[model samples]
Target: MHRITGSHQVQFLDALHRDHVEVEDRVRTNKAMGLARLPSKSWRVNKGWVLTCNLAADLDAWLRLLTLHDDQELARAEPETMRLRIYHLPARLACHARRRLVRIERTWPWAQAFTTSWARLTALPALT
Candidate 1:
């Protein structure tokens, strides 16, 4: 869309191309998440739906980066893979000794991955 020059020419071009690719990837992801449909006839209602969809996508992205970044397969996984493996896996939350704990089937294939990711997420510095 614009010219690139000076000391930052290659850097700018690389960034621009990467951003374009990322946008395309996000568009596909959004479609997979049902963002292609307008939930209501009214523009106002549709606007709200769009906001909700975008928020859900953003939250999914954060969860993937924060929770599952350690595993190579998971780190590159799309939202659908994440949903099946991590989000929809059943777990029970309980409070014990004033601390909340999540209990899951010990035999679950990804239980360890889930717990490790959870611990890493909790240990991260709070975002400002």
Candidate 2:
């Protein structure tokens, strides 16, 4: 429970509490994404590591927002889950005619989600 001074309406306090919770959630996620450990003794090296972690977190957020929005499991997946199921999958790119194709085992559990994400990403307009 939090104690607040002054007269505040219930709705306003609840909204403020929710916003704080959301920020705390993000901080927890960031810690899980590598902010929990500072592996280097040097300040510069630690700064670089933090930057790398931030980049990875941004990429993860984008992946969920852009490609995995329709996939509930993947949209809420943790970093390690995404890595094991999607990023580190055994797949091969094959050139057939004028198009490239991704070939993966049909029996793979998350194969459909992976292929759907790939197709969605490939269908995006290229930047000029």
Candidate 3:
């Protein structure tokens, strides 16, 4: 790395450090979503694993942006918290009027956030 010089060096260094921290945060979150270790020795398998991790990260970001806008706690939640509270909730599937429905216990602590996110997602127009 080239050494930055001149009177602006401190400002440049601060900006660079900020960017570095952001990158590290992304990697930490990715690890939290199962990217901490590769599960296979094969190159192709590792590649697919990495892609899956990336997709999970993207979906988390979009979920926060599109559905969790009003909830500050959930909007800023880490990957593991989201996995536990939203994705891994106890639920049952049922069908009614030709529509499949997931039924979660009303008393679950995160139930409201989960249902709100579900409603927001369903209300969006489907991609053709």
* Candidate 1: tens digits of C-alpha lDDT, residues 1-112: 4553453678777888999999999887787666899888999998888888888888778877887777898877887887777878788889999999888988788788
Candidate number with the higher TM-score (2 or 3): 3
Instruction: Give lDDT tens digits, candidate 2, residues 24-126.
Output: 8777777778889989899999999898888888888887898999888888887878888988888888999999887898889999888888888889899
lDDT of each: 0.82, 0.85, 0.90
The positional error of residue 15 in candidate 2, measured at the CA in angstroms, is 1.6
Model 1 ranges with Cα > 4 A deviation: 1-18, 95-99
Model 3 ranges off by over 4 Å: 1-14
lDDT for model 1 comes to 0.82
lDDT tens per residue, model 3, 30-94 = 88877988999999999999999989888888999999999999988988889889999889999
Which candidate leads the pack in TM-score?
A: 3
Spell out the clash pairs found in candidate 1: none
Better of 1 and 2 by lDDT: 2
Which residue pairs collide in model 3, if any? none
Model 2: colliding residue pairs? none
lDDT of 3 at 42: 98
